[model samples]
Target: MKGKEKIKVGITIGDLNGIGGEIILKTFEDNRMLDFCTPVIFASVKTISYLKKHFKFNLNFNGINTIDKIVHGKINVFNAWNEKYNIEFGKENLKSGELSIKSLKEAVKYLKSGDIDALVTAPINKHNIQSEEFKFPGHTDYLAQELEGNSLMFMVTDTLKVGLLTDHVPVNDVTKHISEKLIKNKLDIINLSLKQDFKVRKPKIAVLGINPHTGDNGVIGKEDDEILRPALSKIREKGMLVFGPYAADSFFGSNNYKNFDAIIASYHDQGLIPFKTLSFGNGVNFTAGLSKVRTSPDHGTAYEIAGKGEADENSFKQAVFTAIKIFKNRKEYKNLTKNPLKPKQKKI
Candidate 1:
């Protein structure tokens, strides 16, 4: 899946005031980086210029009014907005948030039209990028609404893959979100993603407990022993390579995540805290179970280092690479399964 074809990855300028433009420019500065995929950034020409000048980045871009003019081996900037806006670095304003959504909406338009193979979104301030037009918790929900099927926020690195069962919810509200049906459905999505998107045959999944020490046999909390255990049993009965209601506290500390292909966390922080600590500035957040491929840097908008030229672009680069890899993997998987070896009338 490495060099099958050059994929067109459409990028969104998350927040004009944040490090979105900086990382995008940094990642595409290396001419050798265009070997596997062509990048089309959905942003205004003025905005790109502002970032390039402010950061003192040595780079060039191809400007186009539409996706039809996208060219390979060069950074293509598709004009998502024409109006000039202020580049207030390290400050959040309504205009910056509005433009971020504009960029995102334009990128999604091309993505749905099949002009781009996958999408690589830059970091956005969840609070600022909120309005009547965009009223979701984050990119995961927004993309899910645009594309078909469910969406899972899967954080990936070299050694660990973590999926959250409950995303962007309060700690007190986490327990209400957990149920046998929900767990089973998420497990189904994870299993299929491993096979099709990741090419992991016979994938092993590790399920985490909601409570500390896995409830200590109903001492610490009954949700782990009662809710999580039953869900795991039912999931295994369905012929999945799954195990454990492992105690979340000691799971990463003891390095138990290395044994499985993916880990399912009951909530957000349980999985991400460890993943961020381990991968830091290089992890990619992939949205699984959607028809369109979407990925982003695991970290969010770092306002402190917005225009200081100190923001790291490794994670953004990984997001682009990961999107291309998944696109190729899905294509290869589709061709392999287009026809079965056995006759259609034959029963196994």
Candidate 2:
């Protein structure tokens, strides 16, 4: 029951202008991909063909108009994007963004319907996608809305993991969003994700400060001592192991990040800047608190490197593997909780 033996991951091509198409095509380049699990891409045939032809990738694709005709050896594309894409690398426009959003919407349907086990999204341009059909700030919010409002964004790498209490918000608005209720809710989501999705029994997390030197015990800002500390104390009192309102400036450098399972940052850059600096190309952006397992590559639409075959598929591969891993963990955890005393069998 381990590995990718029983899972179906749905992939949504983010922005054709970025490295989304390139990495998707490159990821499926291996003929042995079928050995893992079935990959169902919710993307356009034309766009994928554009990537394959432009990048000179020779992978078999099962281009079908609907979901029923999916099979292996050829990738099953769900035809989420119908429009003929312009496919300009390093360019941002409404058309590409809308198309990316369209794929996301369709993929959600399959995920909710149990047609797909999880979702692996490629990178998208947040700026261009804010218009019209793209009403929400980004995929995290959009997925939250789709799931009826319960989703958290988590950036994960090998060495470090950081979850946001508030994401994609301006510096001014960040303080406004940090409340006791919001902090507790976000912490619950992180704790559940660590156990259910990440397969951790007990998760230890570090809560970061809103100011330098953790408010210097109120010399700088009272938010860390008054707001963050009380919140962390309440969370610890609830039996979850969490600590600090640690100094934002020195947290990444202290090697204390390794002590915790995840870091809960006050703002976007407070956590993401360090996460990105340490894990630029290999990080995975996972949507926790969702009914379905969802993960995406951490980097955004690199339009400058699009269609050049220079885009690395490692992150996309990581996203895919992470989805499969979560899917397995969900299945196994469910089994264990249901029947913990069932005889443990060693593979002999």
Candidate 3:
């Protein structure tokens, strides 16, 4: 990390049976991307080479077994595993899940050790990737346990940003999950993330309601009136620019989301449905409020479009860019805050 050194971004090859390989290769195909950040993919050279040949990509990679051997100007493939994989497109298998977790764990190892500046994970099948070692719902929950701070699933683009209060929970259980403490904690995370990760000076955040039309004063549901409103009021007293519990149905359609720095949705679908609809191929799923930086494409593993070369790499590329930007922003923030400016003495 000297002058003009590129940020080393560690990427995990998620669910090799899916489109992870396709998107990863597609993103690095344009050699100009190397100038931005050095990519270290956590998969074997054999796996990447198989993908290259399967997709007929004219991409070259520098394969290495250790992080010290990473070449800054080329795509570095760190051999997380040595075994050959059977690439069955659009199929779910335990082997793919095992490999995906292996890649992820190896990447996290480097990320924690400061071997990599940031991480950009490829999409993984949530169901198949489950085991005794990994029992979380998805990346956010898993990272929250492994990382230092509370994690928030922040789906972001340049203009639009949405964070979920409760992600990967069933709709039936979503209401039970929302409470005053949860709301305040999530708001705090979102506020801090905006200032440090996204560089917003004064963040104005809006929260969507649990029920339609925000319960219409208790007609639709009581959770919005009984729980969300009070929590938001308490947060506002802390001098944060927080508002809402607005009607979720028409918020984005009415373009009211444009007024705030970020929006906090009550549940997963409430946030991601509108978010994916708006920024599917361009949005980056940033895991905020963690000591380490990690981001991914907004969409999941597109099993249906696995090996057809139809998967758009825009979101994946954006994920890489977002990780690099956040890493630099966090570093700058740390440097600025490490030493506070002393107050000037009054003239005698």
Go through the candidates in order and give the clash count of each: 0, 1, 0
- Pairs that clash in candidate 3: none
Between 2 and 3, whose TM-score is larger?
A: 3
* Candidate 1 lDDT: 0.89
Ranking by TM-score: 3, 1, 2
Give the number of the best model, judged by lDDT.
3
Q: What's the residue-level lDDT of 33 in candidate 1?
A: 79
Model 1: per-residue Cα lDDT over 282-309, one tens digit each? 8999999999999999988899989889
What C-alpha lDDT does candidate 2 achieve relative to the native structure?
Answer: 0.84
- TM-score, cand. 3: 0.96
Clash count for candidate 3 is: 0
Instruction: Give candidate 1's TM-score.
Output: 0.95
lDDT of each: 0.89, 0.84, 0.92
Give the per-residue lDDT of model 2 (tens digit) for 1-348. 123344678999998788888888788888667677788888888877877788788887888777777675457888986778777888889888888888888999988888888999988888777776568878888788777647778999767889999988899988888889999999999998899888779999999998888888789878887788888898899899998878888888988898999999989998999998988678899999987788999888888777677888998898888888888898888898898886778999
Clashing pairs in 2: 90-303
Best model number under TM-score: 3
Native-structure RMSD, model 2: 3.8
Give RMSD to native, each candidate. Answer: 2.9, 3.8, 1.7
lDDT of 3 by residue, 195-243 (tens): 9999998999999999999999998989998999998998899899998
